[model samples]
Target: METKIFAKDQLDEAVDLLAKGELVAFPTETVYGLGAIATNEKSVKGVYAAKGRPSDNPLIVTVSDEEMIARYAKEVPERAKKLIKHFWPGPLTILLFVKPGSLPTAVTGGLDTVAFRCPDDQLTHDLIAKLGYPIVGPSANTSTKPSPTTAQHVYHDLKGKIAGIIDGGPTRVGLESTIVDLSVKTPIVLRPGEITPEEISQVLGEKVLINTGKVSDKEVPKAPGMKYRHYAPSAPVVVVDHVEDFAHIPLNAETGVMALKSELSKIDLPEENKFNLGNDLVDADHNLFGGLRYFDDKKQIKQIYVQGFDEGEESLAYMNRLNKAAAGHHFK
Candidate 1:
């Protein structure tokens, strides 16, 4: 199957289809999003079918500007405003309380809060702007499958499953956005991305609470990627907790290690049993899916082992994607 790469103006047609309740796949700074009108139930439902996602999982609404955000959310908090000024048109997603008549329940999974982001990519922004409505923008792939960072990745996973795909070039972040919930009095980091928690705190002058990684009944998540198994590949992938345990990886001609920056010297695996993405967390995060695709393309590699990151803002989102990509797979 061939993927269609659409120009910015061509995206208007996809937006037209979305207004008529059709699904379209497009790129964002974080990752490619499979979009449909958020208020239209059929459009939202079509997104779920296209990606095989569960109904209970909510989708983030992508808008073109701050004004559009106000149209959906009841109140965008003061701290949220500061963060938006710094991170808007980037990969930061702010979760705010949903207004009474703003959007359909389908977009929020019946929750009173909606996850929203104004994408930095012009092509994606134009699609939402042309539609003149918030669109349900979730990573364009099957639930738990690797999120598409490039248009070809979308076609690789969702070809013939969705109506059309806008093949923008590679995503800048190559991971999902940092999801911050502003509905509460204090800003909390539900999920971290390229925008570190330190950066968020610097802007707000208040320490942002990081989710304890424990699922509690009181927690009302605003986005689909949180506390969920996501971005997994077909083969088993494991994350190593200790560099010393690198040797414990089930090594052979078929096993491969995706190592970290400082720990590369610690890895003594055979050339064929190793693939170096980069040592830096930023590089590792960006090259994650691409490396997975590389290994997946290598027929001899049957299992993949990854080196886990120490806790930090940059590490948080990287770990999130890595953990999920290796979910139901392994730990070491």
Candidate 2:
């Protein structure tokens, strides 16, 4: 359970363990993934057991390239092909109908579709190529917890539960890929991620369907992290409609504000306690977790007052992740 930080040379050992049906933590463009052989039902089950993930929430299959992914999917929709052409080897996961009996039931959560991605990170690609098959990789943390960015974070959450950890350093995106389901005739976005829906629409010439919320069970989801309470911290986080809502909150001497610099200046919070996460979405996206990590370190702060972003495709993915992290802590 002691997660070892494996180097490039040690990646072979990591793959060997995975091939033998043992779990290994490896890096991807989005976040570190707790991986096992996707085709091996027992190995895929280990991923669920290790992360305490539910069977109904499916796992994403990580492959080295587009061709590798084609084998698992029954048919590739035109929209999916356009996206793969434009964004493969990046932080984008496309859902396709599973080729009957090609992948184990566990990978699909018994659903008809499968989520597949070719990560941009070299370590993950190399690991997949070495293993010679797709790997079942969900974020390397317990279901509904903050996604791990580094190997240490993986160890912190999964130290005693997994077999090994391949330390690929911090993830570049620090969030999961946008999951687009192409199984339906019209493309539906099962999950929002770093790649915005607007960006996806530009490629496919159609609006992508946004998920109602992460915890909604209205329909079967195509990927992990959708059916759980996720990206949570130790303290309660409340998302407000505007800065004025801050006044009604009782100053219990344990609350702090997380907002844009412009909003932070307007608020009356003590300068020391005010958490200004950048003025715009780009910087805010980068600062989101760092702010949460800071709060985690402070420990004394009991409540986090988060401000919502204005509506736009650019802000959609960031807001989606933010809302989930807050987990029903939002105000109109």
Candidate 3:
């Protein structure tokens, strides 16, 4: 299929394709999501086929309003309502009990629960609002590659595989939404993103647990990033834990590196091989995926060296993605 790129005002084209049960990628506050009507079984399956995503890994139902979520979810608990009131139109995905037969097995991965997110993008909201239904919004990239932050990135990995793309420019938050599984008695974060567990806890007025460990090979992940080799490029990646560690790392024109401006200034690698992770952690979080994709475009890059941050509240989300992208390879 010829993948068409739609502008903000051209959402009617995207809605038309989605209405016909086609997979069209759309923008979100987080990353570009490969959208299919959450209720359309065939179209939702097409998303897995196009991304080569595992069938067991479920998708997030992206909606514009609370009413849409209510339609599919069995019930939104009082605590969940609080979270939705506080963080809706933002990067927070909550897992809830699914109303029987409300969504397709393809969307729930045959699980009893569903993940729902309302992104903080007017264009995305408008698309869903116009369509009058929610869409499954998984990162618009290949199964294990970096999540697409820009429409061009979506086209690069998914051209001809998907129907079209709604180009809402680059995503504001480079990482995916924070996924909190509230289907259980105790809430646990399945995936970390811009909204940290601490932030979630603050709003809920209770402690929230975070799942930092990897899911076992036998287990099916509740969220996308939990059991996948995600945000990785073709080249091998190594995480450098300290600024001084870069001195020990062997670098060359073909070796790609990512760090803060101060850190990049200290290195002697080729300008083309070096990607600035920005001035601080916030910038690092925003630039992490883009930096990986940048190195991916360079055919000569054999290995990538990235600056690592200590695992903490502010740094958790960034480190989580970097660690996965690097596959726990740290520069010793």
Top-TM-score structure, candidate number: 3
lDDT of 1 by residue, 17-48 (tens): 67788778988888899988888888888888
What tens digits encode model 2's per-residue C-alpha lDDT throughout 192-268?
77888778888999877776754566666667656777777788888876667777776655787888898788777
Q: TM per model?
A: 0.90, 0.89, 0.98
Q: Sort by lDDT, best first: what order? A: 3, 2, 1
In model 3, the runs with Cα more than 4 Å from the true position are: none
Candidate 2, superposed: residue stretches over 4 Å from native: 213-219, 244-249, 261-276, 293-299
Which segments of candidate 1 are over 4 A away from where they belong?
Answer: 1-3, 216-220, 260-273, 297-300, 328-332
lDDT of each: 0.80, 0.81, 0.91
Instruction: Give per-residue CA lDDT, model 3, range 68-179, as digits (tens).
Output: 8889999999989999999998999999999999999999988899999999999999999999999999999998998889999999999999989999998888888899
Ranked by TM-score, the better of candidates 1 and 2 is 1
Error of 3 at 81 (Å): 0.5
Which scores greater on TM-score, model 2 or model 3? 3
Error of 3 at 259 (Å): 0.4
